[model samples]
Target: MEYSFRIQLVAIVSLMLVFPNTQGWGEDGHTIVCSIAQARLSNTAAEKVKELLPPGNDLASMCSWADHVKFYLPWSSALHYIDTPDNLCTYQYERDCKDQNGEKGRCVAGAINNYTTQLLNHGTDNSYNLTQALMFLAHFMGDIHQPLHVGFTSDRGGNSINVHWYTRKQNLHHCWDANIIETAEERFYDSNIDEFIDAIQQNITKTWSSQVEGWETCNSNETTCPDIYASEDIKAACQWAYKGVSDGSVLEDDYFLSRLPIVNLRLAQGGVRLAATLNRIFG
Candidate 1:
């Protein structure tokens, strides 16, 4: 019995070693998206958001609230992502977004649709519902853009792929979500999240102004477009994010420097598109 216990304990510790981290692109990434959206929101949209949030809490503060509650609300966990089939390597709504139970159109993209409708039409239904929609939208918007969140089923969105960031061991998913972005901030932005995001917003506004319409138009007021949008992420993850990653691979400066643009571009797109959604719903 003692030997069996030791074996179980070792397995638990080994799993924990690799899985130790928060879900989704770390809090900083989500907050950066929300904050940029807040900055870009029209006066009316900003006012509406301020009215929805709890007193003293802003959009950025509750950006990760969905992840926090997914423990108890297990039904919503799969709403964070849609897994493209391993061989498929693409996000087809009819193919991928049947939820974990195979229920059609109930993935993160679906969640965005439902929550957006709720906020747009029934935002005043009650405080609880209003808050739920706002939190879901804020979090899901960021999730759909993380690239890995729209990643593969075979490896559990890169979670199953063991990797090392330089010398520290971690999985590909967490590395993209947390480590890479964290390291990017430290190296390029002096670890200043605000300054980095602000500069990203400015650069996006100046350099990608025309592209905003293309991206924002990719998502309509309806939910049908989120699938199309998520496909963009899945394709990106396949061609860019998992490019060189392999079992026991050590990723260093080249990987980080090359992928920072993707991280920044996705962040920029998320913020701008979020602002567009809010403006339409509240305008």
Candidate 2:
């Protein structure tokens, strides 16, 4: 389908809301881990890891990894750190330069870089905890793929943009973080767990290389992916102003549908690359 980014986002948001009570695994962190685990299982080496895990509940293993990895790589908590209206003016002028006198510039870049480093350096040695490490790596990689997570200092990744999600009121950041995917699952997938996982796996295998390269290239820069955040902000702002308005909700549905492929693609890339990284390390 020739879907735009906005349409995909709306679908995702809708999917996210449909399964509100599924578990933390439905969250970005868990979803990323699940995607990576599913990707790994698609390969030969992951077969052994698969054997080691319990049967018929790979999703549980992924969620366990998501929880466990939180320890060694505590930096994932930084993902939750948001910029708010109260704090926007405080850090608005901070430049991309290293000398910028505030936490905003450094925090966003540092979080991404740190997460990447943790993924690369992860192993059973150094208290790396293999399953958890792989899961965490998978989750964090997916986190960075979302542009809002690498967002501007002023708005704290769009957290400041107040809006209503259907009947429930929330901000843009939270909406993107959960609402988009939730909504999509409801409208499109209708809570078919196996189908959801299968679809994500297929998408991952198809677009693995490009997605990995995109993140790897961004990580190479000492600065965070400024272009990623900048481009997303423009799209996000347009989404809010034109489509995501309180009464006029054009962007949510259109954006969700458009961005769904990208999200699926990113999950696919994260899963395959994560398995590749593990195979390289453990094999």
Q: Indicate which candidate wins on TM-score.
A: 1
Candidate 1 matches the true fold with a TM-score of 0.88
**lDDT (Cα, tens digit) per residue for candidate 2, span 100-126:** 333453433344344445544544335
lDDT of 1: 0.80
Give me the candidate number with maximum lDDT: 1
Where does model 2 exceed 4 Å of error? 1-29, 41-60, 63-76, 79-132, 204-252
Predictions: Cα RMSD each: 8.7, 11.0
Tens-place lDDT digits, model 1, residues 2-85: 345345434543453345339977888898889888888899989889976756777887787777666546788889888887
- The candidate 1 region of ten consecutive residues with least summed lDDT is 12-21
- Candidate 1 backbone clash number: 0
Which 10-residue span in candidate 2 carries the lowest summed lDDT? 84-93
Error of 1 at 223 (Å): 7.3
